[model samples]
Target: MTALPLTALPTARPDGCPFDPPRELAALRAGHPVSRMTYPDGHEGWLVTGYGPVRAVLADPRFSSRYELMHFPIPGGPEGTLPPAPVGDMTGIDAPEHTRYRRLLAGRFTARRMRLLTERVEEITAEHLEAMAHGGTETDLVTAFAQPVPALVICELLGVPFADRETFQRHVHTLMSLDVSPEDRVAAVTGMHRYMLDLVCTKRAAPTDDLLGDLTASDLTDEELAGLGGFLLGAGLDTTANMLAHGTFALLTHPEQLAALRADPDLAESAAEELMRYLSVAHTMVRVALEDVELDGRTIKAGETVTLSVEAANRDPERFADPDTLDIRRKATGQLGFGHGIHQCLGAQLARVEMCVALPALVRRFPALRLAVPAAEVPLRTGMNVYGVHRLPVALA
Candidate 1:
């Protein structure tokens, strides 16, 4: 019998190709699509790189998102099985359990609701753009604009104190960091849980008008509420924050698309979608097979993990025509940056509204905006779960 080709997961994009997924991932997608992969912990699994296989796996009920069922993909971590998904961490648990929490929250994040939130998003965008415009000709866009807009919006939506933004954001970065140790990850999550539990208690006593407050009307316990709120805030803040920052970086680098957005702010909607497809900042999605499954000509055994390179799948030439290009006009619907099926990002519409409003506003507000540092000097979040620029310094004029 022939031995299967083996490869390790590729985390870092090649130099000078920050917008691209690791070249090896693309090669695998084109050639292997689904191939044998060795996880850092020495568990051999499957790597699904092409669009077809990735979507199939994500949409399949046989693949489980349960935290305890999977192996950590990161090179170094605690050497043991994970606990079951905490009370309300929808991302780590499969439905009908995920369905209950998702059904409760999905209505609030619907298109109509998000569209209503657009007014507030516009207000926040304007505030940050104004601050950036007046603050200085040069500043880190990440600190000044990208981070705050979504952070503030999510806080307002979730009834979190904007004053506590610094606290949670710090913890979130640690959770998302691939290089962070197991002890640090636990500590950060512990801190977030403590803060969120206190916040949930406050919301329960007073019942402010926001998602958390609304959820408080349900029968969920303080611990469940805390986990859910922390989960929601991390979902709402970190991904959108980096998308804004890194999307801005992508636009600034892709001069033509940037020009298009500045010319017609209406293009922001499509541009945001295209950017999500092109950049795919939340690049990896993990699932473990609950039973033996044949996918794309490969047999994935029961209990083996299948790591999906969303970045690679999004760029699969078969699924997306000229997939590598950053074309703001492309109809980028059905892109899997938000994943597929039940576990798809619940806050996706909210993110769309934020990105549509903020990205164009930033481009138009600073017509002469350019990187304050060289392209290479701007730091990339290469080692983090979220793929983006860590610091984006820009000159606004």
Candidate 2:
């Protein structure tokens, strides 16, 4: 077999087509499913673009998710050896440790448990929509609607005071920002850490009826509880916020599809799924090979890093027909939107509940809703870890 080309990690998306993954990734997936990759640190690695290969790598135990074991792919990202993930940051660890955290948190986020939050999510969504309408016709959906709905829901779930959301939201924005100075990032993280630590202590003294309150009963140490609180807060807030913001941008740009969704409110669930598959807010993830593993006709040697192009994998033509087009009616089951396998997103169900309620509600509330600015002019979160819109300017009818 001819050797595949060695492409650099972090390819750019096509100019003007913000919904699609980097065209280079789509091209690679069409021909070479598995190809050689050169990391920013000059370390040779592997990039998996096909849906099959990407899923296999994520599910395989031989591919370690430990932060210290993997090399950072993006330029100017953390270099050299990184510390192990703290308690509750399951994404950076594997097996028994991750299993432990998953088992403990899984019960709290099950389909049934998350379903209980559906009513509350709807209430939050309605409250935000009302607030937006009261504010005016023209508004930035990111600040007014997208950001607060999830922030408030997650806050209520974790038992954090709703009054303090602004502080945490600012910190999360800074922490997730790709262009923020290292100093700013460090300060954002530290501030959040301090806040979570204090919250954990409060829960210990007066355990309420929230997630943190319930966790206080567990045998987990204070440090672990604090770390876990921060983990949940960041995970629950940033991911869904991006989804809401970016999903709205996508719908406004695709007017035909948006009209279909508006006409049939029942399409909310599938529409959310399709948006997740299309946008793929969490665009990239990495894993390090623990040993020589044969995969898709290529050998991933021990200690080698593999970058999974989630955006590419979700859009693989082999997996979905006409993968580039945004069709809300498409039965987009099995899309790796929230990922797959053991490290799949823990809050997937809750996110679905939020989107299922929010999107349809927004469109239905304002029958004449439309974009306030040119679709191309809307700012995109190009460099952030979470792919989304910086601001979704909308004209509420």
Candidate 3:
């Protein structure tokens, strides 16, 4: 058997198709589902690109999600050994440690809770739509509609004051931005943590009707609550915001899909799912092997980092029919848009509610919505952790 060459991680999306995963990643998935990876730090690891392998790795407990354990894939990403993830950041921990935080917060985001928020999400969606309509024909949809809807929803859920939202949003943008210097990134994160810490302090003094308030009843300390609030805030804001922005961009570019979605408003739910699958905003994740694991007839030795390309997995031909094409009606079941296993997104249901309500509302409200700028001129977040458009200028006729 020919040895599969060691491939570098692909960070660039192919020109003219910003919604699609990098062509290099697609080819890698097709040729070798599990291949050798050479991290920029010169560490040898494995890259799992296929749907099956990516899902398998995510499900296996032997794979560690610790920040201090896994090798960073991107060039100039934190080099050398890193510190352990702070309390309440579930993404950086494994197993029992993760379980504690997940258990404490899971109830807050349960199906019932998310359903209760449905009315609020609808109201929020409508409010944003109304604002966009009033803003005139030519406006950046990202700011006018996409970003605010989710940001406001998350703010309400976390009990953040409406007055602090602009500052909070600014901090989030800085932290998530890829072009910012390390010092600026640190400062942004520090600012957010400080804000969250203050909020946690207030919640401790007097609990309210929000997620943070609900958690204050638990035995968790003030610091832990602050960390958890920050984690949830960042997660809830960036992922769904990008999904709304990029998904709208995808629909606008593919008029047929947008038209079908607009015509059959009942298709909103499925359309949201298809859009999630088609434009996976949270594109990649990393896990480290804690034990020797046999995968696809190859052994991934313990301590080796594995990069799961969620974008590639979602687009795997074997997983979904006509995977590359955006079909609002396609039953996009088993997609990794929210990831898999114990680490699956806790806010998945909330995100779904937001998208199902927001997208359809925008389309129905503005039947003649179209891009103000040329498709090529629409700026994309090619460098951010979440894939999305930097700004979507649209004319809501």
Question: Candidate 3, overall lDDT?
Answer: 0.87
lDDT of 1 at 270: 92
Q: Give the Cα lDDT of each candidate.
A: 0.89, 0.88, 0.87
Misplaced by over 4 Å in model 3 are: none
Write candidate 3's Cα lDDT for 305-372 as tens digits. 89999999999999998899999999998999899999999999999999999998888899998999
State the lDDT of candidate 1 residue by residue for 219-328, as single tens digits. 78899899999999988889998999999999899999899999998898899899999999999999999999999867899999888999999998898899999999
- Over the stretch 116-209, how does candidate 2's per-residue lDDT look in tens digits? 9999999999999999889998999999999899999999999998799888888888877767876897788778888999999988988899
Worst lDDT run of 10 residues, candidate 2, spans: 2-11
Q: How high is the lDDT of residue 381 in model 1?
A: 89
Candidate of highest lDDT: 1
